[model samples]
Target: MSGIVTELWPYIVLILVGYLPNEVWRMLGVAVSHGVDENSELLIWVRAVATAVLAGVVAQLVVDAPGALALVPLSVRLAALAIGFLTFLVIKRSVFAGVMGGQAAMLIGGYLSGVSLMVP
Candidate 1:
């Protein structure tokens, strides 16, 4: 129905424009990695590069956040990051818990810092 299509348009667009493109590459990677040795030097290098990229992104977000995230004090962000990592470890390495903990910490810290969501 037109109503259903209209309501779901954004989700449909997201699947087509965002999810599918990335998923294809993920599937291709899985297919190609089937016979690859996990301990191979090439894989190790790839892992290291991936880790470095992720670390750089995290560092950038903390050091120079964009939009509303920038309103958060650097100390609060740093504390949130640490709390998130500790939550991850304390929760037996559950990434979901870590993310939630980080998000919660950020919200609490931001509130405590008197950051109004609507900054005139």
Candidate 2:
């Protein structure tokens, strides 16, 4: 019993540490957003910043992926991103559609490039 409890302690601590900060902020946001306008300037700015950060992260991944992803050419990744973005716009900004389109593009591009390399 003692050994089991000790072994479980670390997992419990990890769960708490992983969830507490985000949960606290989310609860606070819910409380504070009660009277906030959906179109408020501050909210709009926050949304824009969040979107920019997400874009930067995606760009970083596409540009600097390691291991298997690194094998794909940068041009292919950029082209995939462009296709994804256009698909997103065409589909009224659906993230799922955008991601699927990008993934499909990457797969097709990677296959074609790999074939070309093998032929030469």
Candidate 3:
């Protein structure tokens, strides 16, 4: 037991230091948002801010992707994003379908580009 904890100490620290800090604000937001009107102006503003941030991050990843993601072509990345968004709209705003569609497109691109995937 102690040996396992010792080996996993870094992971435990990361959860406490990284995840916990961000999760606390999310939890607080949920708590505060309770009973608030979902379609209200405040919520709309929040959604807009979140969407803008997400778009910025996505744009950055597509334009200047780091590490393995950089291997995939920009055109392929853009295509995958488009396919995913189309799938989301077609599927009645199903986020799962959108993500799966995007991932499938990305994997297909990776295969076509000769990038290797490891299977355990």
Candidate 4:
């Protein structure tokens, strides 16, 4: 319905707004990386900024995920982060392992802490 779409428009805009900066950087990086040396200052700065942004995003997700983090204690969140880090190390930076391990840790830790949702 028109009313529903009006309500959702802000959320759609927010998603595109959040995504645009990262996607732009990615496209620019890809375009430049072909000709740029790996040790170049521009590449180094881009890598550093990208790393910082990724870390900030992950931290925000862990600390402020609306429904999920609110249902878990800080310790559980920290433990999940640690598990994700360890999984990354053990798997030689396998992104899938790190993500799945972190999610699994959060789910298990939340249930163990009796702070999770009670669903049938």
Q: Identify the candidate with maximal lDDT.
A: 1
Worst 10 residues of 2 by lDDT: 111-120
Ranking by TM-score: 1, 2, 4, 3
- Residue runs of model 4 more than 4 Å from their true location after superposition: 1-39
lDDT, candidate 1, 1-120, per-residue tens: 999999999999999999999899889998989988988998999899999999999999898999988989999999999999999999999999999999899999999998897759
Q: Candidate 3, 67: how far from true, in Å?
A: 1.3
User: Number of clashes in every candidate structure?
Assistant: 0, 0, 0, 0
Model 3's C-alpha root-mean-square deviation from the true structure amounts to 4.4
lDDT of 2 by residue, 1-120 (tens): 999989999888877997786689889988988988998998998799989999899889989986778888989989999999888889989999999998899889988888244533
Candidate whose TM-score is highest = 1
Residue 70's C-alpha lDDT in candidate 3?
88
**Cα RMSD of predicted structure 2:** 4.9
Q: What is the C-alpha RMSD, rounded to one decimal, of candidate 1?
A: 5.1
Predictions in order: lDDT: 0.94, 0.87, 0.91, 0.86
Model 4 Cα lDDT, one tens digit per residue, 11-38: 8887799878668978986786788887
lDDT preference between candidates 1 and 3, better one: 1
